[model samples]
Target: MERLTDFVLRHKLAVVLAWVAVALAGTFAAAAVQDRLGARFGAPGQPAYEANQEIMRTYGGGLVPLVAVATEPVDFARLAPLGRVVTDPAFASDDGGTTYALLYPPQDGDLTEEITQILGPHVRVTGLEALEPEGGGGISLVAEILIGGVGALVVLAFVFGSPLAVVPLVIAAAAVLAAFLAVYGLTYLTDVSGVVQYIVALMGLGIAIDYSLLLVTRWREEGHDVRRAMATAGRAVALSAATVAIGLVATMVLPVPFLRAVGLGGVVIPLVSMAAVLTLLPILLATVGPRIDRGRPKPSRWAGWARRVIRFRWPALLVSTGLLVALSSAALGLNLGEPTSDSLARSGPAYETLAGMREAGLPTGALSPIPVLAPESALPVLRAVPGVETAVVAAPGLIEVIPDYEGTATVENVLASAPPGARVGGAVAQSIGFTASVYGAFPPMLVLVSLATYLMLAFAFRSLVLPLKAVLLNLLSLAAVIGALVLVWQEGHGSEPVWGIQALGAIDEFVPAMIFAFLYGLSMDYEVFILARMREEYDRTGSTDQAIVRGLGSTGRLVTSAALVLFLAFASLAAAPILQVKLFATALGLGILLDATLVRALLLPALVSVMGRWNWWLPSRLSRRATRRAPAPQAGPTSPAG
Candidate 1:
C-alpha cells in the first residue's frame, strides 16, 4: 500500500493526465449510451412477455399506443397521411371529440409531428414516453450531477473545516464521468438500460466523494503523512469498495437482464469511485494536502458522546433497538406495484386526453386497456371478470378489454379468464411479469448477498460472530428504509408535504429490490469502516470498552460526514419528475442518516461495550494464526463528566 501511494505521488502529473484522458473519452461514449439502452423491463419466458411479443407481431400497433383528440368532429381522412395508424371509429367520444389510436414504429417526435400536420392545431397527441418530464437521454445528467455535487461539497467543507474540500469533489466528478463511459462500453457487451447511465453518474458521484472523504480524513488525522494514510485508509477503502461492489454485482446472477444491467452499474460505480480516490486522492494529498489542510480541528463531541454511551450502554442499546423495531413494523403494510401512468402526470396530450375522458365519465381503465388475442368464444369469460368496461373483438382472434379500474385484480382476473386459445397482455401485464421476475430473483439474491457479505467481513475481521452481527444490523437498517417507503409511498402519509409527488397508493416494484441491493452494500460499507477501526484498537489495547471509545472517536466524524454526503446525493434524485425516483431518493436519504447516526455511532458502540472482549473473538486456531492473545485485560476508562 505504501509503495502504491509512493507510485501515485512520484507520478502525480501522469495520474492527472490519465484521468483527464479517461474523462474525455468517456464523454464521447456517453453521447451514444442512450441509443444502446432499452426501456423494457419485462421478463422473458413469462406469460406477459410471450403475450406481449405475440401482440406485437400480429397487431403492429402495440409498440406505439397513443390517443388523438380533436376539438371538432373526428376526421378519418385527415389522419390517413400518418404511417401505420390503427384505431376504431366506435371508441371515439359520443360527441366525436376524442379517439384512441396506436401509431406504429414508436418514434415520439416524428409521430407527434406527423399527427400534428394532419390533425390540425387543435389535436392533442400523446404516447407512453411523452408523459415524463424528460424522455430518453444518457450520461448527460450534468444538471443532476451538479446539484448533488454542490451539496456534497458544502457538507465536505463543514466536515473538513476548509475550502479545499473541492479537491475531492473534482475527483468525484471525474470518476462519475469515467463510470458513465464504462457503462457505455458495457452496452456493446450486452443489453443495458438508458436509465443506468443516469444512475451510474449520480451514484458514482456519491460513492466517489465518500471514498475520497475517507482518504482525506485519514490523511489529515495522520498528520498529513500521505504514505501512512494510504497504507491504512487506502486499504480499507479498497476492501469497502469490494464489499459494496459485491452486493451490487450479485445482481448479475438474477434471471433478468434489466437487473443485471443495473447491477453492473452498481459494480462499476463503487469500483471506479474507489479507483479515483486511491489514485487521484493520494496524489493530491501528497502534493497539495499539507498546504491546504492547515490544522486539526478540536476533537469532536463524538468522543464525549461515546463516553456517555459506554456509561449507559444498556439504556442506549435498548432504546435504539426499540426504535428500530417500531420503525420496521411498517413493513407489514408494504405492497409493491410499479407506478401507474396517471402518476407520471399528464405531461403530454395523450394522457391529457385520456384523463379528460375518464373525468368525462369514461371507464376507470380508459387510459390503459388490455389487448388480448383470444378466440371469439372467450369473450363471455373475459367480460364476466371484474372491472370489465367493454370487450370488443377487433379481429378474429383479437379482443381489447377496457376495464373500469386499474388494479392488480383487474389484470389477474382477465389473465385467469383466458381460455384454451387466449393470451392476455398490455402495460399492466408487462409490469406484473417484471415485478415477478424481480421477486423471483430476490430469494436467491438475499441468500447470495448474506453469504457473500458475511464471508467478506469474516475474512476482513477474522471473527465469525462479528460478521453475522453486521449482516443482521444491515438487515435492520434496510427494514427501517422499507417500512418508511411503505408509510410514505404506499400509505401516502407524507409524500405531498415532503416531496411534490402524490401518493399513487403503490410503490414502484423495481425500486424496493434495487434499494435493497444498494442499501445492503452501503450499510455493510459503513459497518466495515467502524468495525475495522474497532478491531484495530482492540488488538492494540485488549479492552473492548476502551476500543469502542477510541474507535468511535476515530471514525465518528468521517462516517457521519460520508453518510450525510450520500444522503444528500441520493436526495438530489428527488428533483427528477419521476415519482419512482422521488420515492427512492426519499427512502435512501432517510435510511443513510439513520444508519450513520443511530446504528453505527451510538448503537454499535453500546452493543460492543456490553459484549466486551467477545466482540473480537475468532476460532482458536484462527486466532492463533491471525492475532496474539492479549494479556489479561486492564480496566476500561471511567465515565467522564459532561
Candidate 2:
C-alpha cells in the first residue's frame, strides 16, 4: 500500500494525465456501447429456448408475436407484407365485435411503427415490445447521473463540510468512465445486456465515490498523513471493493448468458473504482487534499448514539431486530415471473388498445400465444388441455396454443399434454425455462457465495463469530429489501402513488437473483467498514463496550454517508421506463438504506455488544490454518456498559 502511494505521489502529473485520457476515451465508448448491448433473456440449453430457436428456424418467427386487433375484419392478407401473419377463427372474440391476428416479423426487425402505419388508425397493434412504457418524460442516462451527482455532492458536502466533496466526485467520474471502457471491451467478447450500461454508470458512480470517500475521510482522520491513511483506510477500501466483487462473481458464474454478462460487466465496477481510489486518488490527496480539506472538522453525533445503544443494548437489539423480522416476513410472498400486461404500460396507444380488448371481453392471452412445434396431428390433444383456450396448426409441423392467461401453470398444462416429440416455446414458457435453469442452480450458487464470503471475511477480520454474524445479518437485510420490493412494486402497496406503476403481480424473474448477488456483497461493505474498525478498537482498548462505542462513533457517519451516496445512485435508476430496471433500482436502493440503518447502525452494534467478548473469538486452530500462524490473543472486558 505504501509503495503504491509513493509511486502515485512520485508521478502525480502523469497519473492525472493518464486518467484524463482514459476518461475522454470512455466518453466516446459510452456513446457506442448501446448499439453493442443486447436484451436477450434466453437460457441456453433450456428446452424452451432450444425449442424457440428451432421454431424460429423452421418458421419465420417463434418468440412472442406482435398482435394486431381490429373492430372489423379486413383482408388479413394485407398484414402479410410485415411478416408471416397467423389468423384463426379462435383469434376473434366470442362476441364477434373484436378480432386479432398475430404477426411474426423478422427476428431483428422492429416493425411496431411500420405495422401501425400499414394497419391504419382503427387497428390497435400491441406486442411484448410495444407494451413497454414510453418513458418519454423519464430522465436520460446523462440526466440520471447528473441528478445522482448532484445528490452525492450534497451528501459529500454534509459529510466533509468543505470543498473536499468535489474530490470524491472527480474520482467517481474517472472510475465510471474506466468501467465503461471495460464494459465496452466486454461487448466485443460477449453479448452484453443493455442493463449493464445503466448498472455500470450508476453503480460505478456510487462505488467509486464510496471508495474515495473512505480513503479521503481516513486521510483527514489520520491528520492528513498520506502514508498512514493509505495503510489503514486504504486497506478497508480494498476489502470493501472485494466484498462488492464477491457478490458480482456469483452472477458471472451463472449459466444464463445475459446474466453472466451482467455479472461480468458489474464486477468491473468495483475493480476499476478500486484502481482509481488506490492509484489516482492518492496523488490527488497528496497534492490538493490538504487544501480542499480546509473546512473545520465537526464532531459526529453518531458517537453519542453509539454510546446510548451501548447503555441500553437490550432495547436497541429488540427494536432493530423486530423491525427487520417484520420486513423480512413480507419476502415470503415474493412471486417471480414476468410482469402482467396491465403493469407494462399504463398510458399509451398499446395500453389503450389492450384496454379496448379487455373491454370487448377478448382474452388478453392472445397477446402472448404459446408456439409449440410438434406433428400437426397433436393439435386436438393440445387444444383439449385444461388451461388452453385455443390451439391451431399454424404450419405443417407447428401449432400455436392460446392459454387463458400467460403463466407457468398454463405452460405446464400444455407441456403435460404435448406429444412425445413436441417442444413448447413462448414468452411464458421461456420465463419458466429461465426460472428452472437459472434458479435451479441458485441454491448451490448461494451456498458457494456464502461459504466463499465467509472464508474471505473470516480471514480478513481474523474472527470466526464476527464473519458469521456479518453474513447472517447481510442475508436478513437482503430479505428485508426484497420484502420492501414486494410491498412497493409487486403488491402495489405504494407503487402506484410513488412511481405510477400498478401492481406487477410478480417481480421480474431475474430480479431476485440479481438483487441477492448484488446486495449480498454491497451490504457486506458496511459490515467490513464498521467491523474492521471495531476489531481495531478492541485490540487497542481491550474492552468490548468501548470498542463498540469507539468503532461505531468513528465509522457510523461514514457508513451512512457512503450508503446514502449509493442509494442516490440507485434511486436515479427509478426514472427508467423499463419496469425491470425500475424494480432493480428500487431493490438496491432500499437494500443499501435498510442495511446501512437497521442492519449496520442499530442491529449490528446491539448484537456485537450483546455478544461481548465472543465477537473477537478466533480459535488458534482455525487462525493457524487460515493464516499459517495463530493471531496474538487480546483480552477484553466481557460485559456491555450499563
Candidate 3:
C-alpha cells in the first residue's frame, strides 16, 4: 500500500493526464455503448428454451404472439403478409363487438404498428412485449444519473463542507466513464443487456464516490498524511471492492445467459471504481487535496451515541434484533415470478387495450398463447387439458394452446400431457424454465459466495468470530431487505402510494437473485468499514469498549454518508419506467438504508459489545496459517461496561 501510494504521488501529473485521456475516450464511447446494449432472458438447455429455439427455427417467432384486438373482425388475409396470424371463434367476446387475433411476427421485427394500421383506429394491441413500460431510453438514463449525482453532491457537501466535496464526484465520473469503455469493448464479444448501462452508471457512481470518500476522510483525519491513509483506509477500500466483486461474480454460476452477462458486466463497476480510487484519487489528493480541503472539520455526536449503545447493549440488541426479525418475516410471503400484465404498465395504449379486453370478457391468456411443436394428432389431447380455453393447429406440426390463464400450472400441465417428442414453448413455459434453472442452482451459488466472503473477511480482519459475525449479519440484512421488497412490491403495501406502481402479485423472477447479488456485497461494505475501524482500535488499545466507541465514532458518519449516496443512486434508478429496474432499484435502496441504520448502527455495535472478547477470538492454528503471524491476544479481564 505504501509503495503504491508513493508511486501515485511521485507520478501524479502523468497519472492525471492518462486518466483524463481515458475519461475522454470513455465519454465518446458511452453513446456508442447504448446502441450495442440489448436484453435476452432465456435459459439455454432448459426444456422450454430449447423448444423455443426449435420453434423459432421453424417459424420466425415462437415465444409469445402479439395480440391485436379490434371492434371489427380482423382480416387474417391481410395480416398473413406480416407473419402467421391465428384466430379462433372463442377469441371473440360474447358481446361480438370485440375480436382479437394472435400475430406471430418474425422475432427480428415488430409488427404492432403495421397490424394496428391494417385494422384501423379501433384496433388495440396488448401482449407480453407490448405491456412493458415505455420511454425508459437514453434520455431517462441521463436524467437518472444527473439526479443521483446531484443528490450525491448534496451529501458530499454536508460531509466535507468545502470544495473538496467535488473530488469524490470527479473520481466517480472517471470510474463510471472507464467502466463504460470496458462495457463497450465487452459488447463486441457478447451481447450485454441494456440494464447493464443503468447499473454501470449509477452503481459505479455510488461505489467510486464511496471509495474516494473513505480515502479522503482518512487522509484528512491523519493530518493530510497520504501514506497513513493509503495503508489503513486504502486496505478497507480494496477489501470492500473485492467483496462487491465476489457477490456479483457469483451470479455467473447461474445457467441463465442474461444473468451471466449481467454478472460479467456488473463486475466491471467495482474493479474500475477501485482502480480510480487507488490510483487517480491518490494523485488528486497529493496534488489538489490540500488546496481544496480547507473547511473546518465538524464535531461528531456518534461517539456519544456509540457509548450510549454500549452502555445499554442489552436493550439495543433486543430491540434491533426484534425489528430485523419482524421485517424479515415478510420474506416468507415472497413470490418469485413474472408480473401479471396488469402490473406491467398502468397507463399506456397497450394497458388500455388490455383493460378493454378484460371488460369485454375476453380471456387474458390469449396474450400469452402456448406454442407446441407436435403432430396434428396431439391437438385434441392438448385441448382436453384442464385450464386450456382452446387449441388449434397454427402451422404444420405446430399446435397453439390458449389457456384460461398464463401460469406455471398451465405450462406444467401442457408439458405433462404432450405426446412423446413434443415440445411446448411460450412465455409462461419460458418463465417457469427460467425460475427452475436459475433458482435450482442458487443454493450452491449462495454457499460459494458465503464461503468465499467468510474466508476473505477472516483473512482481512484476522479474526474468525468477527468475519463469521459479519457474514451472518450481512445475510440477515439481505433477508430484511427482501422482506421489505415483498411488502412494497409483492404485497403492494407501499408500492402504489410511493411509486404509483400497483402490487405485482409476484416479484420478477430475476429480481431476488439480482438483489442478493448486489445488496450482499454492498451491505458488507459497511460491515468492512465499521469493523475494520473497530479491529484497528481494538489492536491499538486492547479494550473492546474503547474500540467500539472510537470505531463507531470515527466511521458512523462515513457509513451513513456512503449508504445515503448509494441509496440516492438506487432511488434515481427507481424512477426508470421499466418495472423490473424499478423493483431492483427500490429493493437495493431500501436495503442500503436499512442495513446502515438498523444492522450496522444498532445490531452490529450492540452485538459486538455483548460478545466482548469473543468478538475478537481467533484460533492460534488458523490465525498463524491465515495471517502468517502471531495469534491474536488471549482474552483478558472484561471492561466494566462489558
Candidate 4:
C-alpha cells in the first residue's frame, strides 16, 4: 500500500490525466446506454411467456388492440393515417359509436402523441399503452444528482471543515460515470433493465462518496501522511467493498432476468468506486490534501457527544434498542404485492388518459381490460364469472372477455375455471405472472445472500459471536427499513407532501428482498469499519473499554458522515418519476441514515462497552490466528480529524 501511494504521488499528474480520459469515455458510454436499455420485467419460462408465444404463432407477431370505449364516433377513415385500424362493425358500442384501435407501446416512435392525435378529444384510450415512457427522464435524474451532490457537499464540509471535502464528491462522480460505462457495455451482452441505470447512477453516487470519505478522513487523521493512511484505511475500504459485493453478486443466481441484471449492475458500483478511491484518491490526497488541511474549523462536537455516550452508555443502549425494535415490529403489517400498472409511469399518456376516462364515468378497470380466449363450447361458463363484463367472439374457437369495474378474479382462478382448450391473457395475467416470478424465486436467492454474507463477515471479524451479532443487527436494521418503507409508501406518511408519492396500499414485491440485501450488506460495511478498529486497539492494549471509546470516538463522525452522503444520494431518488425508483430511493436513504446513527454510533459503542472482552471472543477451533489478522496502527502523531 505504501509503495502504491508513493507511485501515485510521484506520477500524480499522469494519474489525473488518465482519469480525465476515463471520465470522457464514461460520459459517451452513459449517453448511448439509454438507446439499448429496455423495461421488460418478464422472466423466461413463466406462463406469460408461453401464452405470448402461442398468441404470436396464431396471429402474426404484433400487439393486439389493448382498449375499447363507447361514445360518439369519429371518422374511422380519418384515423386510418395515424395507424388506427378500424375494427369490425358488429363490435361497435350499443349506440354504434365504439371502435377499437391498436397502440403498440415501447416502440421506436412516439406512440402516445400519435394515439392522442388519431383518437382526438372525444374517443377514450387507456390500458398499458397509456403509460408511454416508463420511469424518469435524464433531466429529472440529473436534478436528483445535482441536489444530492449539494447536500453531500454541505455534510462533507461540516464534517471535515475543509475544501478537501469536495474531493469525495469528485471521486464519487467519476466512479458513478465509470460504472455507467460498464453497464452500457453490459447492455449489449445481456438485456439490462432500465432500473439498473438509476441504481448505478444514484446508489453508486452515494457508495463511491462513502469509500472516498473514509480514505480522505484517514489521510487527515494521519497528519496528511498519504502513504500510512492508504496502508491502513485503504485495506479497510477494499475489504468493505468486497464484503458488500458478496451480497450483490448473489443476486446473479436468481432465475428472474430482471433481478439478475440488477444484481449484475449493482456489483459494478462498488468495484468501480473501490478502484477509483484507491487509485485516484491517493493522487488527490498526496497533491492537494495538505493545502486544504490548513485552517481547519473549530473543534467538532462529536467528541463531546462520544464522551456523553460513554458516560451514559447503559441508558443509550436501552433507549436505542427499544426504538429499533418498535420500528422493526411494523414489518408484520407489510403487504407483499407488486406495484400496479398505474404506478409504473405516473406522468404519461397511459396514466393521464385513464384519469380522464375515470372522471368521465367510465369503469375503473376499463383501461386494463382482460381477454380470455376460450372455445365456443365454454362461452356460457366464461360469461358466468362475476368479474366478466363482456364476452365477445373473435373467431370460431376464440372468445374475448372484458372484466368489470371491480374485477377481483385473478389469472390463476380464471385459468382453472376456463374451458379445457381456453387461455386467459392481457395486462392482468402479465402482472400476476411477473409478481409470481419475482416472489417465487425470492426464498432461494435470500438464502444464498444470507449464508454467503454471514460467512464473509465471520471471516472478516474473526469471531463467531461478533459475526452473529453483526448479522442479527443487520437483520433488525433491514426490518426497520422495511417498516419505514411500508409506513411511507403504503400508509402515505410523509409521502405526498414531500415527493408526491401516493399511498400505494401495497409495495413492489421485489422491494423486501432488495431492502434486505442492500441494507444488510451496507450496515455490515459500517460494522467492519468500527469493529476492525476496535479489534486493533484491543489487540494492542487488551483493554476493551479503552478500545471501544477510542475506536468509536475516532471513526464515529467519519462513518456517520459517509452514511449521510449516501442518504442524500438515495433521498434524491424519491423524486424520480418511476414508482420503483421512488420506493428504492426513499427506503435505502432512510435505512442508511438510521443505521449509521442510531445503530452504529449509539447502539454499537454502548454494546461494545457492555460486552467488554466478549466482543472479541472466538471458539478454540477457529484458532487465535483468526482472532487477529491485521496489526494495530503504529503509535504516532494524530491530526485534528481524529
Candidate 5:
C-alpha cells in the first residue's frame, strides 16, 4: 500500500492524464452505447419481439397498466391525430392482446409527439389525454425513491463543507454520462430494451457516485498527497465496491430478465466509475490541490461533541443499545406488502393525470391481482381459505383473488391466504409442486430473500452478534422511512393542498423487498467500512475508547460525505418520468441518510462505547493470529485530506 501511494505521488500528472483520457473515451463510448442500448433494451414500442426487425414492441401501461378515460369525447376532427397518440411507435402489441399506448411525456416532448403522429389512429385516447408529451407514472416513482437522496446531499454539504466535496459529484456525473453512452453503443452489438437502459442508468449512476464518494473522501483522508491519497483510497474502496458489485451481480441468481439486466448494468457502471475516481479524481485534485480545500470550514463543535461521546464509554453504549432495541421493535411493527403506483407517483404531469382520473372515481389500483394456481379446477378448494376475497380463474391453471389487505401475505397464508410468512415462498413453490400458479408472492418472496441475505451477511461479518445487530438496526431505519412513506402516501400525511398527489392504496408489491435488499446491503457496507476502521484502530492500541474516538473522527467525515453523494445520485432518478422509479429512488436515498447519520454516527457509536473492551472480546479460539499481535502505540500521525 505504501509503495503504491509512493508511485502515485511520483507520477501524479501521468496518472491524472491517463484517467482523463479514459473517462473521455469511456464517455464517448458510453454515450454511443447508451443510444444503442436504448435501441436494444429501451422501452418496447409494442409487445412483440420481432427477430426479423430485431425489436421488441412494448404494450399496455406496463406492470399493472393504467386504463383511464377522461370524460372528454373524441372529436371527429382530432380523432385521426388522437389515434396516433394511442398507436404511436412507442406502443407495441402484446401476446395478451392488451391495448397499449405511449404518451409523449412532457419531459421527453418533441420526440414523443413525432412518434404519436406516426402511429396515427390505431390507438385510443384516455383520461385527460394530451397530444403533447407527458411524464409516466414510473417517473413519479423515481422521484419518490429519490427524496431521501436529495436530503442527503444537503446533509453532505453541511457535513463536509469543503470544495473538495464537489469533486465526487463531478466524477459521478461524468461516470454516469460515460456509462449511459457506452450502454447505448452496445445496442449495435445486441438487442437492448429502452426501459432496461433506463434501469441500468438509474442503478449505475446511483452506485457509481456512491463508490466514487467513498473512494475520493477516503483517499484525501489517508494519503499525504493527491496521488498517494488516490492509491490508498482506491485500494480500500475498490475492495468494498467489489463486494457490493458482487452482491448486486448475485441478483442474476433470480429468474427475472429485467432484474438480470439491472444487475449487469449495475456492476459495469460502478466498476468503471471506481476506476475513474481512483485515477482522474486524484489528478483533478492535484491540479486544483489547494483549491480542493476551499470552503472547508474549521472542524465544528459536532466533531468535539462526537469525540467526547466516545470518551465517556458507558453512557454512549447504554444510549445506543437502548435506541437500537427500541427502533428495532418499531421495525417489527412495519407492514410488509406490495407498493402501489400511487405510492410511487410524485407531483408531476403523470401524477396530475392520475389524480384527475382518480377523482373521477376510477379504480387506481389497476390489476394487481394475486394468482393462485391449482390443477383441474381447484379454485373452489383454495377459495375456502380465509381472506380470499372473490377468486376467479383468470387463465387456465390460474386463479386470481383479492387479498384481505389487513395482514401480510404470509399472515394471510396462515390464517386464510397461503401459509405462514416463513413458508410463503419456497414452501408454496414446493407445496404447489407445479400444479398451482401464483403472482402476488413476488413481494413475499422478496422479503424472504432479504431475510436470507441478512443471514449471509452475518456469516460474512464473522460475528453473529454484530451482524444481527446490524440487521436489526437496518430494519429500524427502513421501518422508520417506510412508515413515514406509508403515512404520507397511503394515509395522506400532508396532502390536501401541499403536493396535490392523493394517498394511493397499498404500497407496490415489489417496493419493500427491493428496498430491503438494496438498503440492507448498503447499510451493511457502511457498518463494515466504519467498523473495520475502528477495529483496526483498536487492534493498534487496546484502548477501545480512544479507537472509537479517533476512528469515528477520521471516517465520520468521509462516510457522511459518501452518503451524501450517493443520496444525490439516487435522488436524480426522481427526474425520471416513472412513478415507481421516483418512489424507489426517494425511499432508498432517505434510507442511506438515516443509516449514515442516525444509525452509524449516533447509534452504532453509542453501542461501541458501552461494549468497550467487550466489543473486541472475541473468544480466544475465535480470534485470528493477527488480532493477537502486540498493540501499536496510540500516537501515530492522523491521515490527512489531500
Candidate 6:
C-alpha cells in the first residue's frame, strides 16, 4: 500500500497525463461514434434505434406515444381537430381509434396492448403530448436561470470558501452542455428520442462537475505546491471516476433505449470532465496561484464539530446510531409506487392542458391500467377473473382487459388502469416470454433488480450486517428525496411559493426508478471507495478510534471535494428543459448532498464508532478471511502532532 501511494505520488504528472489522454480519446471516440454508441440500444440486428424510424415510417409518425381523449359527452368543437389528427397522413390508428398505432412497429406486444387499452376509451388524442417547442419559452428560461444558475451558485458557496470552486464546476458544466448538444446533433444522424438526448446531456454535466470537485478539493488540501497538488488530486479522482464509470456501465444491461443512453452518458461525460480537471483545473490552479485560496472564511462551527466527532469514539457511535434511527423511520414512509402519467406532466404546460381536458369531461379516474394482450379466444377467461374490469377482443390474438383498481395497481390492470406487475418490466417481459411486454413489466421488475443489486453489494462486502446498513442508509436518502418531490410536484404544497412552478401530479414512472438505480450505484461507489481506504488504515493500525479520525480526516478533503463535483454534475441535469430530467437531476443531486454530509460525514463515522469491535465482526466460518483485527476504542487523537 505504501509502495502504491509512493508510486502514485512520485509520478503524479505521468499518471494524470495518461488518464487525461485515455479519457480524451474515449470522449472523442464516443462523440465521433456517438451515433454508434447510441445505436447500441436498438433492435437485435440493426444499429441504434433506427427501428423506431421504420416503425414510424411503416406505422407513420414519430416514436413518442400519443395520448387519445375519450368521452361520451365530448366537446365536439374542442375535439373536432383531433379526429383529423387521428387519421392524419402523419398518424396511424388501429381498433377504430381503440389503439393509437405506433409510428413504428410496436416495441413489445404488451406495450402495444396497454396502449390499445388506454386509447380504447378515449375519443380524442394528440401525439403523446409533445414537449414544449425547441429553444424553450419564458418558463424554461426562468427554470434554467433559477435551477441551474442560482442553484449552482448557492451550492458552490456552501461547499467551497473561495470563488475558485466555481471554476471547475463551470468547466464540468460546459463539458456536459457540449455533450448534450452533441447528442442533439446525433439525433439528425441517428434515430434518437429527444427526451433521451436531453437526459444524457444533463447526466453528463452533473457527474463531470461532481468528480472534478472531488479532485480539486483534494488537490487544495494536500499540495505544498498547487501544481503537484493538482496532479496528485487529479490522479486519485481519475481512478475514482473510473470506478464510477464501471458502475454506470453496468446499467447497459437494461433494454430501454433511454436508460442505455443515460448509462453511456454517465460513463462518457465523467471521463470527459475528468480530463478537463486534470488538464484545465491543474493549469488554472497554477496560473491563479495562491490567489485561489484567498478570502476563505473561518471554518464553520459544524466543521469544528466534524473534527471532534471524527476523533472521538462514543460520540461518533452516537451520531451514526441516531441517524440510523431517524433515517430508518423516514425510509418507512416511502411510497414506491410507479408515478402516473398525470404525475409526469406536473413539470410542464402540458399538465394544465390535460387538467383542463379532464375538467371538460375526460375519464380522469385512477391512472391508466395495464393492458393485457392475449389470444382473442381468451377474452372470456380473462373477464372471468375476479379482478378483471372489462375485456374485449380487438385483433386475432388481442384481448384487452381493465382490472378492478387496487391500491398497488399491479400489471393485472393492463388495458384499463395501467398494468399489474408492470412495476417489474423485465420480469414481466421474461415471464410473458418472447420480447413481449418489456415496458409493461418494467415498473415491477426493477424492484427485484434493485434488491438483487443490494445482495451483490452484500456479497462483495462479505457482511450481512454492513450491506443491510448501506442499503438502509441509501433508502433513507431516497425516501427523503421522494417526500420532497411529492410535496413539491404532487400536492403542490409549496412549489409556487418556493421554486416558482405549479405542482404537477406524479413524476414519470421511469424517472424515480432510474434515479434510484443510478444513484444507488453511485452512492455505493463512494461507500465502497471510502470504506476501502478506511479498512486499509485500520489494517495497518490497531487503534479503531485513531483509524476513524485519521481515515476521515485524511480523506476529509477528498470526500468534500468529490461531493462538490458530484453535486455540480447532478445540478447540470436540472438545467434541462424537460421536467422529468429535472426531477431526476434534482433527486440525484440532492441525494449526493445528503449522502456526503449526513450519511458519510455524520452518520457513517458515528455508526463505526458505536459498532466498535462489532464493525468488522464476521462469522467463525469467515474467520479465515478476517486475519487482522480492527483497532479497539480509545480516547485521543493518534496523528503525530506537529
The predicted structure with the larger lDDT, 1 or 5, is 1
TM-score of each: 0.86, 0.93, 0.93, 0.83, 0.62, 0.59
Q: Where does model 4 exceed 4 Å of error?
A: 1-18, 53-68, 71-138, 297-300, 303-315, 336-365, 394-398, 405-409, 627-642
Per-residue lDDT for 1-642 in model 4, tens only? 677777877888888898888889899988889888888765567665566555545643233344534356655445445442324454444445445443323233444445556667666565644443333332476788888889999998887777887888889889988998899889879988887878888788888888888888778778888888888788788878987887776567766777778888888988999989989999888777788776464454655666677788899999999999888888778876534445445665456655655555444444444455566777788767666655666555555555555223644556668777676665557656766777677678767767776777667666655676777778788889888988887777867667655566677666776766566667777887888777767766767666776677678877888888888887777667776777887888888988999998888877777765666666554645654445322222231112
**Global lDDT of each candidate:** 0.75, 0.85, 0.87, 0.70, 0.50, 0.49
- Measured over all alpha carbons after superposition, the RMSD of each candidate to the real structure, in angstroms, is 4.6, 2.8, 2.7, 5.8, 10.5, 9.5
- Candidate 3: residue 48 lDDT (0-100): 86
Hey, what RMSD does candidate 2 come out at?
Answer: 2.8
How many pairs of residues collide in each model?
A: 1, 0, 0, 3, 99, 58
Whole-structure CA lDDT of model 3: 0.87
Model 4 scores worst on lDDT over the 10 consecutive residues at: 633-642
- Report how far off residue 67 is in candidate 6 (Å): 9.1
Query: What TM-score does structure 1 among the candidates reach?
Result: 0.86
State candidate 5's TM-score: 0.62
Candidate 2: Cα lDDT at 216 = 87
After superposition, which runs of candidate 1 have C-alpha atoms over 4 Å from their true positions?
6-17, 31-35, 62-140, 338-362, 625-642
Tens digits of per-residue lDDT for model 1 on 1-642? Answer: 778777888898999999999989888876777788887666787787788788777765553355565556556445644444445665666666566554444333436666777777777665444553351122336777778888898888888777668888988878887887888888889888766766787778788888888788878878888888887788889888988887787677777777788888778888889889999888777777778876556587777888899999999999999889888999877767645556554445656765776655655464467878888788788888887877877566878787786567788888877777687888788778878787887888788889988887877787776788898888998998898888876766777566544555667677887788777788777888888888778767867777788888888888988898887777676666555667776787888888998899877888888877666556666655554563223222342211
lDDT of 4 at 102: 39
Deviation from truth (RMSD, Å), model 6:
9.5
lDDT by residue (tens digit), candidate 5, 264-315: 5656665767666665665666677466665544463445656777666467
lDDT of 3 by residue, 1-642 (tens): 889988988888899999999899999888899889997777889988888888878877556678888888667557777777887676788889998888888763456678768777778788877775442432488999999999999999999999999999999999999999999999999878999999999999999998998999999999988889999999999999999999998789988879888988999998999999999988888778999998977787899999999999999999999989998999999887766686677777888899898899888888878899899999888999888988888889888898887666777899898888888888778888889999999999999999999999988988878989999999888899999999998888887787666677888789999999988899999999999999999888888889999999999999999999999999888887677898899999999999999999999999999989887777788778976878766453562434
Candidate 5 residues lying further than 4 Å off, grouped into runs, are 1-18, 29-166, 181-223, 226-232, 284-297, 300-303, 307-472, 494-499, 618-642
